[model samples]
Target: MPMKVRGAPQAVVAILAFAGIVVALMQTMMIPLIPQLPRLLHATPSDATWAITATLLTGAVATPVVGRLGDMYGKRRMLLIGLALLVLGSFIGALSGTLAPMVVGRSLQGLAMGVIPLGISVMRDVLPADRLGSATALMSASLGVGGALGLPAAALVAERADWHLLFWTAAGFGVLAMALVLAVVPESQVRGGGRFDVVGAAGLSAGLSCLLLAVSKGVDWGGQVTAGLLGTSAILLGLWGWWELRTGEPLVDLRTSARRQVLLTNLASAVFGFGMFAMTMVLPQLLQLPRSTGYGLGTTMLGVGLTLAPSGLVMMAMSPVSARISRARGPKVTLMAGALVVAAGYGLGVLMMSALWQLVFVSSVIGAGIGLAYGAMPALIMSAVPIGETAAANSLNTLMRAIGTSISSAVAGVILANLTNAAGLPTLDGFRLVMAIGGGASLVAIAIAAFLPAHRVPAGTLPGREPSARRAVRISARPRPAERAGLPGEDE
Candidate 1:
């Protein structure tokens, strides 16, 4: 099709959505290979765990930094850089046959986690005001989409082919996404004009690394180390906060983030992340547990993957519904609704986890909730902050979710490790306990979201929400930084 005739906006949404999915795939791609890591990499089990930890730490650090970079420079440019990192990491991981290089590669792959936020930021820049909500919703939901879709496929590849193919396949998708982005996506003109905050970045990275390290590794490392790490993290983060408030170009705007809308949303996002990850962590183990254990389903990895795949598809399907809900009831309402749905899902999981069909039903219900809340988050954040800060703000929200999940996993691990049946198998009660915690987290999310200030970005201000001429003045009163900077407005 000729360039003029092409539906460029639609194409941009599709490409960016696909890119988000591709990056998310990296998160769960290692799930199937985790057990085999010690043997495959000729490393100790403890050491092999770094393959997972490396990604978590780097992702936590990279998210805010990448967001700041995207704000200062261009979202599209940072997005491509993130994709290139994934490609490079995937290639290195594909070629690695041992532990050290594998950790290095996986850490590199983690940097790409920022792609989803950057993509959402770009949509704000380049997409029409009318298409923004749904487009951004779909992009946000891609985190769940790739994660859900990746597990079964990765299980299949891990079982049927060489393990190296997993990373190779990831690399292949990365390359394709990069090509599509470069070909069709234009550089966003909107920029947060400022110098990069190196001090802020380094400080945030250090604090987060210590904080997450404590949370994620506490189960393995025991009490004293965990407590010390936690204490150290608290100190460093306290200092980091002090510096951020005083700095000119901070990695995260603490004051803006402290606003009622942004603060509550981040808190809710964290709880939602924890709640959503509960089903994911528990279901697989329950499905793959030995049938002799009575409560265990005694299935293979592929069986577990297949049983859980519907949740991801459900998430993708529900994104538009979520967007519609946000449009009608407002994003805060959508978020609260999603939290309730997730709580209901976890409640059901607590009640009916013995059967495969039951697990599938429960997961899908939670997926629907995730789709709704995830879709609303960017809308809430974008409306609260200036156009220039969207990427950084979204990145911080994404980091909050990551922190939630990391903490959730650690908490679940501790519970499961200590509470077991006579056969040493994790008992049904323990699983229910996790579900209860998940449900509780969702309730907390609802409480936080309920307190968010009542406001909506008008149509035309938001990509999809087009206010009428009468209302446009009120919406457009605060011109985007691009307009003030005297650059020709490209989209928003």
Candidate 2:
């Protein structure tokens, strides 16, 4: 009789994808709690806002460092460490009744964001070449999936249960993800054996912290403080670049990253991130805006969640389709196509701002485009970089996306803040302006993607299908660098 069970590759991919979704859920779960934070923590609004800032700051710092560590030691090992941080942070967030502990807890949660890239790297090392495209795409889409689905659900829980329950819930899921990783996910033996680059890591962290703090918090801190932070970031980043070029065991391989494909992909990733977030920030406000405003839909948070939830599903659903496009056309083409779709979606959003259905249409269309772009990104990065540096490259890409989102928040917030109506509320014109910007950003990303080199399918192979021969070369049903290739194990 034929075997009754799923393939080992299938199990590993499923478990890791679930882990990605859970970790992503941690990010959006806190959104509904933001408004109530000042009252809940008995602090000023500015102090309470630190909960969000702390996570953003820590995430930007941790993504690259953790990626390098994952490459040097073990991808699976670093992923576990990331999950542990999530569990610990979730519990801390649950127990905290004040701003300080809350900030600390949230920072740890930010640190856990590294797991997404690590998970993607592990997919490359462990999965058969054929499974690589689709699995990584799904894992990447989980970031959006978790965020979209998390909002309304998180809002409901915060509205009814004690808000602490949200963190408790996240902690529970983190524990489940940990257990799944131990049981199903194999440790990759593909270690980039080298000493950790302390100087590069510190320089990058300081530079990112300075820049993101200035971008994210500039509105509150005023122009001079923002200028000072920006100046400091510039100096630190320049020094960091010099040190990286000199370091024997650099934390990030600037030379490899400078290659045309990797460089352009990262640039486009940032723009795409900015475009995605512009929709995320504006749509909710449009939904919640008071009915007295001529354009407001006047919906509840739950309505917002329901409207956005379908986009997450659409993103998940589009993964295989995106993969097919990448296989048939090159991922560069896939990326450009995705960016164009996003541009089209946002352009439609600018005109169709009237009803719930129109917003749903807009979100779903944008989500589909984002899924395509994100799914193609790993393919572009992994194809360009060596097997050993997969984690680092992917992590760096993720960092770019995060930076893009931060910038989007700053820029979008500025637009909405300044373009207010007579009553001082953001007018329909303000949102349409944001939507126009989002479309323009997506179009810009498409232009960037146009610069990417074309991909040619080797002769005698079918388009849109992973080579069947490659699919058959299974690697010992374990997640290690191939013994056939004389690769060293993680313990080495």
lDDT against the true structure, each candidate: 0.86, 0.84
Off by over 4 Å in 1: 1-7, 456-492
**Backbone clashes under 3 angstroms, per model:** 10, 0
How well does model 2 score by local distance difference test? 0.84
Q: Any runs in candidate 2 off by more than 4 Å, and if so which?
A: 1-7, 457-492
- List the lowest-lDDT window of 10 residues for candidate 2: 483-492
Compared with the true structure, what per-residue lDDT tens digits does model 1 show for residues 1-492? 111212478999999999999999998899998889899999998889999999999999999999988887788899999999999999999999999999999999999999999999888767766677889999999999999999999999999999999999999999999999999887776677777878888888988998998998886788899999999888989998999888766778887787677888899999889888888779999999998988999999999889989999999998888778777767888899999999999999999987889999999999999999999999888877766777999999999999999999988988898899887778889999999999999999999988886644454345223323112111212233334332111112
* Model 2 agreement with the true structure over 1-492: per-residue lDDT tens digits: 111223398888888888888888876887777778899999999888899999899989999999999988888899999999999999999999999999989999999999999999888766766667888889888888888988889989988899999999999999999998998787777777778999999999999999999998899999999999999999999999999988777888887777777899999999989988988889999998988888999998888889899999999998888788887877888888888888999999999989999999999999999899989988788766656777999999999999998999999999999989888878888898888898899999999988877774333222222344222122222222222132211111
Best by TM-score: 1
lDDT of 1 at 172: 95
